[model samples]
Target: MTIKPLVIALGLITGSVVLSACNSTNDNKTPITDTQNLAAQHSDAKPVVYQVFTRLFGNTNSNNIPWGTKEQNGVGKFADFTPKALSEIKAMGVSHVWYTGVLHHALVGDYTEYGIVLDDPDVVKGRAGSPYAVKDYYNVNPDLAVNPANRLAEFEALIARTHEAGMKVVIDIVPNHVARNYQSLSAPQGISDFGANDDTSVTYARDNNFYYVTGEDFSVPSSQDYQVLGGEPHPLADGQFTESPAKWTGNGARAAQPHIHDWYETVKVNYGVKPDGSYDFATLPAQYAQLDYRAHYAFWQDKKLPDSWYKFRDITYYWLDKGVDGFRYDMAEMVPVEFWSFLNASIKMKNPDAFLLAEVYNPTLYRAYIEQGKMDYLYDKVGLYDSLKALMQGKGTAQQVLDVHASVKDIAPHMLHFLENHDEQRIASPEFAGDANKGKPAMVVSHLLSQSPTLLYFAQSVGEDGSEMAGFGKPSRTSIFDYIGVPAHQAWMNQGKFDGALLSEEQKALRAYYQKLMNMASFSAIAQGELVSTPVTTRSGQSATNVIGFGRQSESQRLVVISNFDADAPQTVSVTLPAGWQGNAIDRLEQHGQVALNNNQLTVTLAPLASAVFELEN
Candidate 1:
């Protein structure tokens, strides 16, 4: 909506990638009359997301003990998110900051000094617990606060600071489950804890917050050598925790003692689902799929909702009231889609533009989650991300990226794309691409492949290999369960200046490339452009399967993006431009020389694992 001339100026200074002037005639801006108008506003400005594990983002401590106490391996605090740090993040072209692990979760820390009871080590995952195993919905994690008693206030200050830096805030809302000891010490008056009013006599109840296994006490799993806190001697690590009438594990394990592989630290929340997985509540009508959130909220207003539904509704409202812009639901597919309809509808009614993203891996359920559940976006992990990963590892081809895009073409705009996240392996890891630069080509394609938001993990920009040998978190991922400092990212932190002052030359180049690509993608032309596939064909050269090409176009601007997937081979490929798309080529990614078009066809040779984004206009 706020079209600026700066994009055109930047484009000119950077070789004028496309020939069209940045300023567009009002005549060419067609009015959107449908609900898509709300979505279109997003297209005009590209969304760059920087995800940070709040506990690790600002921790300058390099003493990374695998299973050490918070004292041994320091933790990051809300106070660490200084204005200067946030400014640097914003300067990196980020629109949203996903502060992971901001909520109160069951952890191994002893907070008894602050009037909070100690978390049993047996039930907690590691020194820093899994953020997904939320314990208190109303309070911030005590570990993240500079003053343990002022944790919530500290979090609020961070939110205010993030907004001041022109970035929206996104926090996790793990709907599928909660810590086995589901107690909220800071719940607002008149609110009750989960299962407080439930009848434990029955195995299943329509209003029960959790499913019960009658006559059984909770017991620890027998197999697997893994232990809480890595088997460090502790008074609470005696392999026992108390739970009367054991509940089902988060992963739907019904056994009194779940297997070691099961999510033993958390218990699944029942959302009006019967023991047999049948719905016990009314579902949204098929006609409600296209309705706005207000309508969906109205439809459920007069209806009798489940207890679990009201609890989640209250939780989300609490955050929204605290200036939280949106939520990223964890393992959302495990919860029924109907519950999401109610939950998301309530949030949207309060804030119409709230960003609601969910992790739903079932490709079969992507559409249902987006349309029926009224979600803004769903992870395209199984589609776009998987295809790209395979192609990067030489196990697949560029044709697969095209195929995956075609499969999700109808919903492409609603799908969020990312090459790295806390859940995925780092692209630079030995198990992955084995080099940092390999991510360049993949990033160019991923960000420009569609008109959707792109996410980058905390250390991803600096080429953090994510290789670590920790007690809880597996190697090849930045440790989310342990108190660990990311070496590459810490260098960028540079003792709180956050200017990447200590980064290596290659690391600096990688970060610069990301900034350029992200800034280029932020231009209205690429952000709001309609996607067009311009497949490359090998002509009069050695045939190779290492190239991929595509284009995006607005009424006045067009950009052609091509990348060589092979790390060892330079590729030569040809693409025929659409009629009326003519201009001197400008390499938008690196601001290099032009590649002229002849007979409406253009050919380019790229260095190994290199990419090009060329702008074209008549």
Candidate 2:
């Protein structure tokens, strides 16, 4: 099948969009497809929004939230937020609610002192580490399960309640590796070697698929690709931050440790082994191999895991019974396409409308997930990343934004958008949040022109100010490696920790404004409208990067957004309109003066580190 055109695409080849002093304007261009109308229609399409993750609602915690109990911070399903939290997100006009870590075991918890993950041997201790790394695919950790007393039915009830509340629950599914204490590989009949698993009941041939490597060429990736020479062996393995595991270590890919490696009980699956890169999906009861992996995947992939690990198509009765609206596969990169076909095909067959959000990142790896009808919308990381950077850097002009829209309109009208996720650094990573206006535009622009199915991380909504404490290796940001910024910069995070935000007052107002825009998009034509642009002229430089202005127009309504990208510059510029557009433009924000747009052209004045929006004649 040929590829579908994108709903929002990158015109990156139009050359890089850098904030500049001035550039020539193109007023004669009309894009091939009328995105303006489509965007208007799309605004009515609700965004399938999901949360980051929370692991405190485990069986042992109070209220037994599954990942954590009410007593244990009660934030159990962070992404699965409480009624109050749900209301907050719903207020934002969002759809899907993803209570991230709603699946089975794998000891979770990292003993975080705020943003900093303490040195626990295994890293999955009780301070709420990411819920992605699974411990047991079948067994839903009692803590997060709806009711530990009755795992099966309770789990069903949770799903039912989520549906009743008008939201679909999405869980995390990892096909890479199982818990280190995986009962299948540690049994007596097991050879303590390949081919024989802990279950001892099934041989390696029948146990499912995984690759095991015996030697070390193990290179751990800790820093950015450009900065780091190569992936290095973690000097801090499990929990021993002091000692590095050198030479060829024992055969345990990842294992269960005491205080050291307590949190995660996983063994990373080897994607490189079984050379020639062959992965058997051979046929029948071996269509069964694919089937088994699917069954395992379904368990931890939602907020409410099923009581038992059952086959995929067969699981439909439970899904309808549970009232689930979708499934978002985790770590989809490692799963083979042939195997994934059944997943998407089966779900659509079961309910035709089940939304599938696969965690496949790379284009080559996620192609099948996107094109095969396997997923309604796969997460587009680079696309989201680029759009976010463009706005934050104050470079995505009206031309830049529309050029992007023209490109991706058909590829997938609805794609998942994001800034920071559980796996990456919180946007507050000092390296990125270098702004005094508190980085509000970063958050605002993301949700504003983003594709549908947007993802908002834990601290993103509130502009939670701070940095990542579980920063995988770099003990410090500098040579001395001391906790200087944490205590002083983030007093709220009294520890040597930082908040996950940097939103300014204007940025906050902008965020509220865009949020309204998002809601308008949800029920209006903004999302599906045909996109058109109006250009604004401004000088850009180190202090003037903040000066940006542009207009996005839909058939029924035409709106203009303008802002100063630079935090330090004070300046003004002239803006031009589309060929047929005309009107007395009104500034959405209080501005000093107004410009008369004549024959589709208008000269306007702007302030430093400030923005304004104008509404044109409908």
Candidate 3:
């Protein structure tokens, strides 16, 4: 039932604020569901997210040559997401499976054998291609399917099986840009491609799908000492693409040939925002903040929208029909917030529980993006993730972490936390901590810090040192650009048994620790509890600067978490708990029974880079 815009305006004229149909938290209280309480016996856990780079997650090949082709290093397929693998992932305390790089992106692989159009090598990033450079919004990546013609069907089967394993699915939606060779062979009937209806003669237009450099041909930038596929000879790698009117680069570059530092593989999408940053779209009323998606949808029903906005709207609706539960929007801040309000509202009207996560980094715009854009969550990279990374690197202090919590306490639930992702340096890489065990304390803090969802990359559990320089550019982090198999993760895969039978004892122990912590975090208290910071001091009155402590409590339960961040020494730290909370502490991670908490305080010794979760007794 669509409410007319006229009726909405009349209602708005009478009432200053629209009411929310869903529960809007003061952003403080975290509520646990009965389902979570049932899982609490094993470990009261929050939402543990397992993010798999779809192309690389199931690859078991070990030939990690730089600039390797698919045949050389192997690619994971949708067929590899077997029922056994999904069950194992579910058993690892994962509530959601984020399938990254599922869409049809620009890649060097030939799919013409399946009648799919080929992307030009000059515009593609690497042999595997950048997932951000989307080529077709409506089709699944043929690289991920055993039979390229059945790509979408394979993905749909994966989605159904994921649900059968009691986990939700998340896929990326690269709304900010598309590859220079964007073409949608599988788009629904009557749907036009991006830039198909644009006025190419103008540099900027309110209705144009992209910003263009009028009367100019697109040229490859010569600034960087780079070549397509590291100068490997190919007929299509002749430093030429065929865009007659060159559009602006994805990263807002206005040059005919974008700088090497710019996002040259893709072209930016234009919302109604002009070059001067003036908006041409209708503004949402301030009263819309407290409104539910239905109200927001009703408010925008009769209004006219720009062509790009409608194109994206169609793209999202198409995915929703494919059994996708949510989207992790790429570079969402680049699109106008007004467009998001319309798009998200439309989506929520169709499926109100749809998860809408945005990659917005600017702290100042966080509130606006959540309230105005209706995003369910935003990456907490600039807050908790960055702080813990610095602390892990031994250049930051534990106090800075507390300061970060204080800064975002009001919006904590909406901040998604992670130590590693496709764009960030791996925790085991030299550029970062250079040790996978260092992630223990940081992961403890990230999961126990708030009621927010926690994310982990595929190999983070098994300690894949991200040193595979597989291609495209200088490599320190795991190569998302090239064909490479994560050695540690492949060991766990164990040639499709989906067991850690081949892992070293240390690797197996690391996986066990992750499972314990992640399952413990699933507890009701941690999932829905309020955080209270505890002072870290010892019985001898020595302040433990290398230790951090905090408590999570619900109406029925309480738990205290403490971690030692020092790299080489064990520390005995005393934590000052809240009044009236004294009990026998059971170590959730190490499984130590009955460490007493006397007189509102608990003192425990922790190994270097170790973390302990203490379940409090009455």
Candidate 4:
């Protein structure tokens, strides 16, 4: 058996928030040896935190609260997510909880004094959705307030509750765009600074202005894509485009203007330009009544957003002082990298150990965001892309998966790795899981990627069935055509199965085996083991291309993880265990899969889409 390693809980100092952790006992009696030597080698070592989705102002459903909403339905009192949500997350042994969509909703005007209107589809999916597109930067969504407390008190209390739960809270930030319901645009109160645009230059800001649907210059008649909010008509270079009122699925996203609804909804901020290299907004307005008309939106060369443009910088210490652990940046790529570098430093100045996770979608290369250390950890797309590809096509060797992992390791936090998130399709589906008949290869690779931290989305542990209606921008419903079919929650109930699920009676046993494996390893160096690639037997065909093997070792812990990408047959793999690897090693994911050193020669049989985690027995 491997010796138990020492625990150093005070290493992460970027914005170090104290973690109150419970004793982590194994679920079953699987006395795995300690693997502490592994932690010293991981230069990118940090804590692994789990994230949960909570809806903002839209979802009022008492039982079904969408991911980003802050309020509960059929209830007048504010949604109390503090101790309630953190307590449940802590119960699962997770040290951190990422609470999404708790910010103030600047979307709706004071129709309800809270500024969040339930009528907008963008805010709520079919009247209940996760909050992504934001409107205001300050204040808490009134639905998140239990008492008549200010934004500061609510946030401070939330952080304190999280700390008290023996955990940390990672709030979401959207630097890309805000719901265009501009409290900032309203003259005395609104922020009308779009770069260099002037009051006379409103015509240059036509992209954000409104127009009539059939207004003479508008070409398309009834298509739902072209949106025209009510206000003033905007003239584009090609022709005048008008707005559509019903584009929003449920409520709205700057869907309607002051003339239409009592509540102010969301608006669409320009991403700076149209794709065609042409500036949509220019200094021109249509002559109303053959005389003169007002320009739609004033054009501003506001490419560089001022600090006061958004409340991101202003609200940093507010929550930090309240004792929130950190901020996991949402869409870090959307904003300039320079901005985050400054923010992360500023946050560190206040409290080190403030973790920063950037949501760089499908960024496997890691060159741009991860290497810079603009934030602590960025998303890993290697496993998600290649694993899904291998599972669906039943092609490629395990080497492909390893290559991606190695690449992901370079540019990203060595500790960072994730499979499924709230934004993507569930891993429990056929596309990434292969067929229901045999076990899914992607699922195994997800868990078997050495001891690196793997993120588990809320429904991922239980199982989230496929969605025909699920969309990246808009969350869709499950298609009746799919095998999982309707009745909704039933698919999730069977633990992600149409009929032939990925986890077999044998695989179910393996799942328990790995949970114990993770619990034991987390206490030692295995959580942050150093990654090193094993020499390839053949560098050529499916056999040559398919198998990918790598070993993660520290002073005490040595583990070899082999994942087969080919679906048809077992890939032949010969991985030699590295030297000085004296420790008790076992396959963390597979109970029977293990390799002992006979002059460091080990031959492993890896099934297609399956991965095995090996531990070194000293």
C-alpha-based local distance difference test score of model 2 = 0.42
Model 4 error, position 596 (Å): 3.4
What C-alpha lDDT do the candidate models reach, one value each? 0.80, 0.42, 0.80, 0.42
Best by TM-score: 1
**Backbone collisions counted per model:** 0, 101, 7, 70
Where model 1 places Cα greater than 4 Å from the true spot, the runs are 1-43, 541-544
lDDT of 1 by residue, 1-618 (tens): 001111000000101111122221111232211236335536657677789999998788888778877787788999989999999888878888999999999888888887777888788777788888888999999999989999999999999999999999999998878999778889999999988998887888989998888999999887567766776798888889899999888877788898777788888788888876567777778767677677778888888878999999999999999999999988787777778888988998888778888887767677677767787878889888999999899998888777777766656667789999988889999998889888888999888876678888888889999876656867888888878888998999998988889999999999998888877757655677777767588866543466888778876778888999988978788877677667677887874468888877778988888899988646
lDDT, candidate 3, 162-270, per-residue tens: 9999888989988777999889889999999999989898988888989899999999877457878888988888888888899988877888898766788888788
Give the CA lDDT, 0 to 100, for residue 118 in model 4: 31
| TM-score for each predicted model, relative to the true structure | 0.93, 0.62, 0.93, 0.62
Question: How do the residues 1-618 of candidate 4 rate in per-residue lDDT, one tens digit apiece?
Answer: 000121111111121122122232111111111112113323333354676544321122323322212232222122344355455445544666776656654322123453343333322112222345444455555544455345547666667777888777777766544543323211224434322132222322333322121212212223244232211122221222233332211111222222222112223233223222233322112121111001111111233433332345556765666566777665555443334444554565555556567765535223334322235556665454545455445565555555555444333233355555655555556555523222334544444454544565554444444443322122232211101122222222243232224434643443344344334335333455456555545423124465556666666666676666565787666676556554445776654455555566566666655667777775
Per-prediction CA RMSD (Å): 9.0, 11.5, 6.5, 14.6
| Predicted candidate 2 versus true structure: per-residue lDDT over 241-308, tens digit per residue | 22122111112222122112122224433322222334333311222222322442453244231111
Ordered from best to worst TM-score, the candidate numbers read 1, 3, 2, 4
